[model samples]
Each structure stands twice: as C-alpha cells, then as structure tokens.
Target: MWQIAVVLFGVANAVQVDFRPYDHSAELLFNGSDFNHDHIFSRQELEQEFQKYDADGDGRVSRHEYTTYVTTSVPELHDFAHALYDDYDVSGDHHLDHHDYDMYYAKLDADSDGSVTRQEFVDYWVKLFQATEHLHGHGHSGHG
Candidate 1:
C-alpha cells in the first residue's frame, strides 16, 4: 500500500536524470500519509536538507538549530524534535555532523551493513505501518 508508493517515490526521486515517475501522482499518493520530503530525499537531497539546518555554515547542526528547523519547517514534530535529536545525535555532543547523519540512516539500515538501500527503507516503513495500524482507530471515543 503506502509502503509500495514510498519505495517507488524513493527510487524515482533518487534518479539524477530528468525522469520523474512519481510526479504525476505524488500528491494523490502522499497527501494523507506521513511520507514527506524526508522520505523521498536522495542522498544529495538529504545532504542539502542537512545543510539547511546547519546554520553558520559550520557543517554540523546543533540541537537548537535542528529544533528550530523542525519548528519552522514541520511544526507538528517540533515537540518531538528533541527525541529525534537524541536518536540521531549518536556522539552525545548535542550536534549532528555528517557522520551523525549517516548514523541516522544507519538506524534504518535494517541489516546493519552500514547503508540503507531502498528495500530496507520500504521494509522499515511497512513494519512501522504494521506496528501502528492497530492503534490507528482505537483511541477515538466516537462521541463526535
């Protein structure tokens, strides 16, 4: 379902050439899903996005900088940014350098081989879907 679309979008977005397989349906495909710019960022795009958060052009994003980026760019996750920072900032230095970014992807590596292939990324989403599906409609009180 959504996982399939994510892999498709990931591959399409990763291509350097002008080929855009998902352009036609990108909105219809991802409008309601949590899949966003981050999910489809190519290796280059990921680096660019990291640089966006790396204020002062220091090549590293401090926790405060990342929190600010998330606050302005994706406010829905701002409250959780610190948790994400804790997860991605592996060195405990409260900053995310290139290696820390690599560690972020490695968390999704699935196989621990130091890289996150498309398949691994899609699998991770699928598993996350499965794990969260049961909680989707259970919290509502149905009073509205």
Candidate 2:
C-alpha cells in the first residue's frame, strides 16, 4: 500500500511536466531516498525555481523576495512552500518564483488540487525523503 502511494504520488506530481530524477547517489547527499533524490525537489528543480522567481531576469535573487503563494480552506499552499523553500533557495538566495513554486506545488499536490497545506508537506517529504529509507549514516555513507 505504501509503495503504491509512492508510485502514484510521483505520477501525480509530474502530471504535466517532465521531471527526471537525477543520480543522487552520485552527489552523495542522500535525502534518505533514491539514486536521484528526485522524489523530493532536486537541485535541478531549485534552478528552475530560481529562473522562475527571478522576476527581473537579473540572474540572482534578493533575500525575502516576495511572490505569490495563495491559500484556501482546501490547503496545500503552505505545504508546498514548506517542502520547497530551503531547497529551492539555491545559492542561498532565499526566494522562489512561479517556476519553483509550481514545480514543488505540483509535487505536494499529488492529486492536483492546485494548492498545498502543512500536512501535505510532512506527508510528501516523508515519502520522498524517509519512505524509501535510503539514508545510511554519519557525515556521509553512500558516496563513492
């Protein structure tokens, strides 16, 4: 049942986009799952997000750069932001755009609700980062 959910969740997240999970073992970060760690948002995802949020096309993001992240009683918006924030803030720029937002929102909104909530953040991250249980140990264990 859990495995089914994982597969379905992945399929759902990638509804309209073509996201290829990278070779995570190659990078050795091991967010506790998969060779690509793509089940969660990968660096590729962050870059894409950066491009999206960089509204000025300046090629760099300013700190706390404001953008839209809508919410409703339906939930999912907050959850999507939680899942993506730190990760998508590549170069530590600390901001995101519709590209990054949409990418992760899609991931969290596995059922395609057009929004995300806090619980979805925990659930999706748990599956992508913990469900596969790919972590090994210490400062780094899987790298070779």
Candidate 3:
C-alpha cells in the first residue's frame, strides 16, 4: 500500500515542470547525508542531517520546521511533507526527538547493519514518497 503511494508520488511529480523524481530526490538526500563521502550514511551523518532540519537550534524538530525544510530543500515532496513528518514523529508528539530519530534510522537501515547504504536509503525514500502519495490521494496523471 505504501509502496503504491511512493511510486504514484514520483509519477505525479514527474508531470510538473519542477518535478524531481523520487530516485533523484533520494539520491540527493543520500549524497548530502554522506558528509564524509564514505558511501555509507553513519548514524553521526544522519544526525547531522537531522540537525539541519532542527531549525532554531532546538534539540527537537517541530512539524513546521520539518515541513519547511522539506518543501524548501525538496519542493517535489511538499505535498507529502506532513506525512513524512508524522512518520518520523513516531511518538505522535507533534515533534521529532532522539527516540524518533532512532526509530527512523532503524527503519532506513534495512539490514540492521548499523549503517545505511545508498541503495537502502534511496529505496526507502522512494517507497515512502509513493506511499504518501497514495495515502494522500494524489492522483497520478500518467503523463510523465
């Protein structure tokens, strides 16, 4: 079900003039998160990226902060920003903290090997976007 949304989201975005395919978005995220260029996303690197979303220097990330960052950094994801935020906010507290981060990281780390590979990261995000699209009822035009 979620996978359907992720793919639909990608297709929908592909139709827009400013559309950025889910794979591209995932690639950017993976590359950007790999600060050390090690081809692997370490927990530290992930946390660093998280901090970028933690605007205002607060220890936690509010829904607004996350949505702003996503829409600003990856406009194609704007429609699914809230869904993404809610997903990360596992505790349903309207904010993302260390616990949420840990859960998210675990989810991204599909192999449970403590680090995220480019493939793992990209696949996860693409699927997530597709799922969000389905959940949000973002109709796919199949035009692009």
Model 1 Cα lDDT, one tens digit per residue, 1-144:
121233211243231111123332233233322235444424444455567678788898898888887656334344345655676687788888888767666666777865455555555544443444332221223232
lDDT of each residue in 1-144, candidate 3, tens digit only: 112222323454353322137777678777777889999988787677778788898899998898887666345555567877887787899988888878888999999998889999989988876676553444544565
Ranking by TM-score: 3, 1, 2
Cα lDDT, all candidates? 0.51, 0.38, 0.71
Clashing residue pairs in all predictions, respectively, total 0, 10, 7
Best by lDDT: 3
- Mark the regions of model 3 whose C-alpha exceeds 4 Å error after superposition: 1-21, 72-78, 134-144
How much RMSD separates candidate 2 from the native structure? 16.3
- TM-score for each predicted model, relative to the true structure: 0.52, 0.28, 0.72
User: Given candidate 2, what's the lDDT at residue 35?
Assistant: 26
Q: Which candidate wins on TM-score?
A: 3
